[model samples]
Target: MIQDRYSLAFRLYPYARSADQDATDPVRHPVVIMGGGPVGVALALDLGLQGIPVVVLDDHEGIGQGSRAICFSKRTLEICDRYGAAGPMLDKGIAWTLGKVFHDDRKVFEFNLLPEDGHRFPAFINLQQPWFEKFLIDRVRQAQAEGAPIALRGRNRVDAVAPRDDHVLLDITTPEGPYRIAADWLIGCDGASSPLRGMLGLGFVGEVFKDSFLIADIRMKADFPTERWFWFEPWFKSGASTLLHRQPDDIWRVDFQIGWDVDRAEELKEDNIRRRLDAMLGDGVGYDIVWSSIYTFQCRRMERFRHGRVLFAGDAAHQVSPFGARGANSGLQDVDNLGWKLGMVIRGRAPEALLDSYHEERAHGADENILHSTRATDFITPKTPISHVFRNAVLDLAERHAFARPLVNSGRLSVPCSYDGLSLTGVDGLGGPDRTRPGSPCPDAPLGDGFLLPRLGGDFVILAIDAEAPETMTQDGVTARRLAVSAAQDPSGALAARYLGAAPGAVYLIRPDQHVVARWAQYDETALRAALRRACAKE
Candidate 1:
C-alpha cells in the first residue's frame, strides 16, 4: 500500500523562536515572504540574486503531495533558467510541443505549439510539481551556500499581520512556539486559500465551475507519447473530456472530467481507478495508479494585490482554473516582475511607488489567465445544454474545416501576458512581430553558441541592432549596456526578423525583468535614459 506521507519533507531549517516581543517592536527584515512554495522560493532566489535579504515562512516542512501543476510553460522555464533551476528541471522533464485533440472516434486538428526553433527551451514540458519545487529549493540552498541573504524557515506559519506605515508586522506560530517579526516590505506567496489573505480580510472574487475533475498519475508500460492528447467523449470513459500527459519516471498523468455530484470517495478508490485504467488502456495493459485526486475548478483573483506595505503574488494574489497551466506559470511571472522592482525599492534606487507596477503587471497577467481558463472551462463543461451542443458542433467542424480549428480550445496553452499600453510602456519605435513589440517579452534568438534570454536576464540592457553602440547610458540606479548585433551575430536572421523586421539602426530598451520597455529608430542617449527611468517608475 502506497502510504500518503508528507515524508518527502526536507530537513528543518534552524530558526530562533521569539515568543516574547513588544507589540510595537520586532526584529525587522527587508522582505518577509509568507509561503515557501514555488512562488515564494522564486522570489527569495530573485532577491538573493540581487543581494537583498529575504525571509520565507511556510507551514509545511517540504514539497506538497501528488504530481500537481504538471505542465510548465516556456516563459516559466525561462524564469526558472534565470534562477538556476532549469538545468535540473530540463534533465528530469518530458519536453513536448505537439498536442492532438480527439473527438470520440474522429481525430480533430493537432497543434505544434512552437514550430520554429531559435528559442532555448520548448513550448512546454511535463514535470511533477514536487520535483520542480525541489529543484528551486536546491537553487535557493546553493545561493545560501554562496552567502546570498535568504532564510527559509519551514513549519513557520504566519498567524497575524499588522500593516504599518513603513513596515508590516507578522505574528507567527512555529512548531516550538509563537513569535513575532516585522518586515520593511511583506509579500504573500502563500497560495490559494492563503492565511495571510484571510488575515487581511481581502476579497478573492471570480467564477467557480460546477464540474469536478479527477487527476490520476499512473505508472505503466504503455505506448503513450510525450505529446499531449485531449479528448471529448472518448468511448473508454463517460461522456466527458480526458487529458493525457507524460511525466518523468514513466508516469502518465490522466485527467478525467468527472461531472459534479460524483461520489469522490468511491471514484478515488484503487479498484475504481484500476478499472478506469483498464478500460482506457485495455485489460492486458499492466498499470499501477500512483496518485489520484478530485478537485473543483475555480477562477478567482483579489480586488488588488497591493495592500499598504504588504503585497500578494501567486495564488495569494489570484487564481485560475488549472486548464492553461497559468496558476504556477503566472505566479512565477509575478515573482519575476516583483523581485526586481522590490529589490530596487529596498536599495533606494526607485521610489516605493515602483512596487505599484508589480500589482499592475501581475494583475493584468492574472486577468488574462482567468479569462482564458474561464473560457476553457465553459467550453469543456457547458452549463447549458445549448452550449454543450455548440461545443460539439465546433469539435465536429474542427475535424474537417481549418477555419473552425481556431475555435477549438483544449486549454488555450499558456503564453506570456504583454503590458502594451501600461504606464511604463515607452514608445514603440518600430514595427515587429506581435510578440516582439514594446511591453512584451523579448523574442529569443541564437547568440554566440547560446540563446538570448540568458544574456538579457538580470539587468536592463539596450540592444544596438544594426546601429552604432552607445558609449554609456545610466539612470536612477539602472545602467544600460549596448549589445551590438549584426548579420553575423545571428546567422539565421531570426533576431532581425523578430526584432528589427525591415527597419535598420533600431535599438530597444529592455527592463531588468527582460520586458521590452521602449525602442528607438536610432539610439538617442537622452531618450534611452528617459525610457529607462520610465521603466523603473522613477520618471
Candidate 2:
C-alpha cells in the first residue's frame, strides 16, 4: 500500500521556535515553489539556471497518469529549449504541422501553421504530460548532478503557509518527517484546489461551465491521419461533442462531452466507456482502453495573483477550458515571466516593486486566456437552441468564406498576448518615432552574426545604436550591451523596423524578461541609467 507520509505539523507563529536547533535548523531559499507539476518544475529549472536555489513540493508521488494538454505552442517550445529540455521533449513528442476543423461530417476549415518565415519552433507538438514530466524530472536530476541544489520533494504536502515581511514560513510534511522551510518568496503552482491561495483569502473569480468532459486514451486500430485533430459536433446519439487526436506510442486521446446531468462515476466505468467508444467508432475496429476520466471545464481566475509574499501561478491562479489548449501553455508563460524577475530580485539586482509586475502582466494574460477559452467553449457547446443555430450558421459561412478562415481557426489555438498596462512599456512619454513602446516584448532582429533581442541571457539588456555606455552597464549591476543593426544589411526589413524603427540611432532598454523598459531615438545616458536604476530597484 502507498502510505501517505506525514513529516511536519508546525504551526504559524510570529517568531521562530528556536534559533539553535541544528546545523541546518531551517534552510531558507530565495524562492520556494509549492507543487511539483510542470509549471513548478519549469520555474525551478529557470531559476536554477540563473543560479538561484529552489525547493519544489508536491503531494503526489509521481507525474499524473494519461495524456493531458498534449499541444505545445511555439513559445512554450522556445522556453523549454531555453531550459535545455526541448531536445528530449521534441524527440518524444509528435510534431504536427496541420490542423483540420470539421462540421456536419465535412471539412469546414483547415490551418497550416508552418509559417513561411517567422517562428523558431514549429507551430505545435503533441506530447503526453506524463512523458513530459519524466523529461523534466530527468533535467532536474541532471542539474542536481552538476551541483545545482534544486530539491524535488514529492510525497510532501504543504500543511500551512505564513507570509513574513522578509520571507514566507512553510509547514510541510514529507516521509522523512515534518519540516519547516523559510523562503524569500513562495509561489503556489498547486493547481485548482490550491491550499496556499485559499489560505491567503484570494478568490478565484470566474464561471464554471455546466458541461463535463470525459477524456480517454486508448490503443485503437484505425487509419486516422495523425497530423489532424478532428472535432465532431452532435458527435453521437446522446448529442455529445467529440474531439480526437493521435498521440505518441500509437495511442489516441478522445475527449467526449458528457452532459452536466450525467453521473461521473458511471461515465468513468471502463466497460461503459468502451461500449460508448465502440458505438461511436462502429464495431470492426480493434482497440484497448488505456485510461479514462471525467473533468468539468472552468474559466476562472484568481482575484489577485499575489497576496503579500505568496504568489499564485498556473491553474492555482486561473483555469481555462481545454478547447484551446490555453491552460498549461499559459501557465508555462507565467513561470517564464516570473522566474527571471524572482531571480533578479533575490540577487539584489531588482527592487521588490518589480514583484508586483508579475500580477500585473500575468493576470492580464490569464484573463485574456479565460475570455478566449470561454468564448471557444461557448462556440463549441451551444447551450440553447438559438446558440446552436448561430453556431451552425457561423460554421456554414466559414466553409465558403475565405476571410472567415482565420476567425474559425483562432478558436482552437493559442497566441501571444500583448502586455498593454505595463509601466515599463514606455508608450506615452518616450520621445521616439512611436515605434518602440515600453512594456512591449523586445522585438527580435538579425544581428551581424546572430539574433539580437533574445540574446540577453536571463538578464537585463540595453540596446544602443550610438549611445555612450552608462557606468552601470558594466557587470556591477545588470548586464547591458549595444546592438547596432544597420539598415543597409537588413535582410528582413519588417523585423529590423520592429526594434530599430525608422530612426538611424536609437536606444532600447530591455528587462530581464525581455520586455522593453524604455526606448529613445537618440543616446540619453542619464535616462537610460535612470531606467536601469528603476529596474534594478525592483529587486
Candidate 3:
C-alpha cells in the first residue's frame, strides 16, 4: 500500500498496492496543460482561481534564461490583475511611457502610450522574462498554499497525447517513470515545434523569413535612458538592424542582425559576439555578455486551434516575428479567450459548441497579427531590392508627412484585436455604429466612488444604469440586469448607443472575457430572458 497520502500513486489510486498498480490506473484532472511557459502558467492560475483543478507539465527544470518578451500591455496587466498577479509584477517590472523609431541616426516617429485615463496602472511594463516567470511561479505557489488543487510537474516531458470522443489522454515521462493522465481538455502550449500539434495532425501554414537575427543580453555601463525601447535600421558598420530594451537589473537586451550567410556555429563565438557588442556600444563602454542566440523569424499559424478535445495555444498555435512583440502577448490573449469558455463547458454551464469559437476568433486574430508583424519586419530590414527601395522612400516620406508616421508605426507594436464577424459577438446594427459596439471590448468609465472597469469581477458583467428598480432577466442559466437610462444622464455616449440604441432604457450582457454577448434597445423581460438563455446555453 502507498505510505504517502499525497503521492501521485496515492492520488491516482488511493488504495493502490504499489507503483505497478498505480501505473494501470489513470490520473485525471479537469484540465491538463502541457508546457510550463507563461501561457500555460497563466491558464493554470486563471482556472485555479475559478476553483478548477489543473495539472501543468513541463520539461524544463525552471524558467529559462535570457530575455524573450519583456513588454506587457495594459490589457494583459488587467488580466493578470484578475488573478491577483499584477501587483508583484508591477513592483518588479519597469513601466515604460515612451518608445521611439529611428532610421539611420534620425528619429522618424515616436509614441507616448500614457493618456488621460482613470486607470491606476501604466500603459506598458518592461521586465525580464526570467523574473516575470518567477513572479508567476510565486503567485501559483501562493494559490496552491491556499488549497488550490493545482500541480506543476517540472522535468516532465509529454511523450504523446491521444484525444478520444470523451476525453484526452497524455503520456508523460519523467525521471521517475512514465505516467498516463486523462483530462477533460488538453492545452498544448509547447512552443513552435509542438509535438502535441504534430500528433494531432494539425499543420501550421504561413511564411518564414529567410533572414536570421542575433539576440544578446548584456550589462552596460553607458548613460542611456532606461525608459524607452530604441530600434535602429541599417545598424552598425555591417548595416544590420538592431534593437535595445532596458531590463530590471541594469541589464540590457540587444538584437543584432546576423545575415543568413553567416556560419551559425562560427558566428556565435564569444569573442566575435563581444566584438560586435563593443562596436555597437562604442569602444569606451565596458560590458559583459549575459546570453546570446540566433533566431529565424517566421509568421506561421496553425490551421485549426482546436483538434477534437485537444487545443493549441501560444506559439504552438501561431508565431510572429519579434518586431511587434506580438508572439507572447498574442499567446496570453489566447489563454484569456479560451480559459473561461473551457470553464463554462467543464462546469456544464455552456455546451461544447462554445469551444468552437476559440478557433474561429483566435485564428483570425493570429492571422492579423502575423500580417502586422511581417510588415514591420519588412519595413525595418528590407530583404529584397524592391523592399529596400520602398523602405528608403517611406522613410523619406515620413520625414515630410506627419500622416505617414502613424502608418509606419502601426505594424511595429501591439493593438487590441477585435472579433467583428464572430457569431457569438452578435450583429452590428445598420445605424451609426458605436465605437464600443457589440463584439468590441467594453470601454472603461469612471464610477461615482472609484474606477468602474477594474471593479468588474471575473464573471460576465450586466451593466444596468438604474440603481433602483433594475429589472433582472435570466436565460438558459445566464442572467442579465435591465436598467432605466435617460439620454441626459448617459456619461459614455458609446455605451448608451450600444445598449439602448436611441431608446432611453436598455440592457446589455457582457461575457466573462469582456466581449458583449447580447444587447437590447428596450428591456423586455421575456425576450431578454430568451437571449440570455441562448447565449448562456450557447447552442
Q: Point to the candidate with the largest lDDT.
A: 1
Predicted model with the maximum TM-score: 1
Per-residue lDDT over 138-210 for candidate 1, one digit per residue giving the tens place of the 0 to 100 score: 9998999999999888777788889989999888877676778989989999889898888988888778789
C-alpha lDDT of residue 386 in model 1: 97
Q: What does each candidate score in C-alpha RMSD?
A: 2.7, 5.3, 5.4
lDDT of 2 by residue, 171-268 (tens): 77655556787888899999888888877777777787999888888897678886665564734542356777888888888888778998888878
Pairs of residues clashing in candidate 3: 475-533, 476-533
> For residue 17, what is the lDDT in candidate 1?
51
Q: Residue 222 deviation, candidate 3, in Å?
A: 3.8
Q: In terms of TM-score, which candidate is stronger, 1 or 2?
A: 1
Worst 10 residues of 1 by lDDT: 1-10
Query: Residue 417 deviation, candidate 1, in Å?
Result: 0.7
lDDT of 3 by residue, 1-539 (tens): 11221112011101212242165678667898987778989999888878899888776656766677888877777778877888888998888777767777777777777654555567778887766667777888899999876787765677887788888977777666677878888999888888788777787788878787788888876677855545546455432667777877778888777677778777678888887777777777888888788888789998889887888899999999887778888888888889888988898878888888889889988988998898887777677899778777777678778877765642456755877757577543223236456666655544544444565557765555432234555566654544343434536454444344555554566677666655555344554455455455454
lDDT of each: 0.85, 0.73, 0.71
How would you order the candidates by lDDT, starting with the best? 1, 2, 3
Q: Give residue 200's error in model 1 in angstroms.
A: 0.4
Model 3 per-residue lDDT at 503: 52
lDDT of 2: 0.73
Q: lDDT value for candidate 3?
A: 0.71
Give the C-alpha lDDT of model 1.
0.85
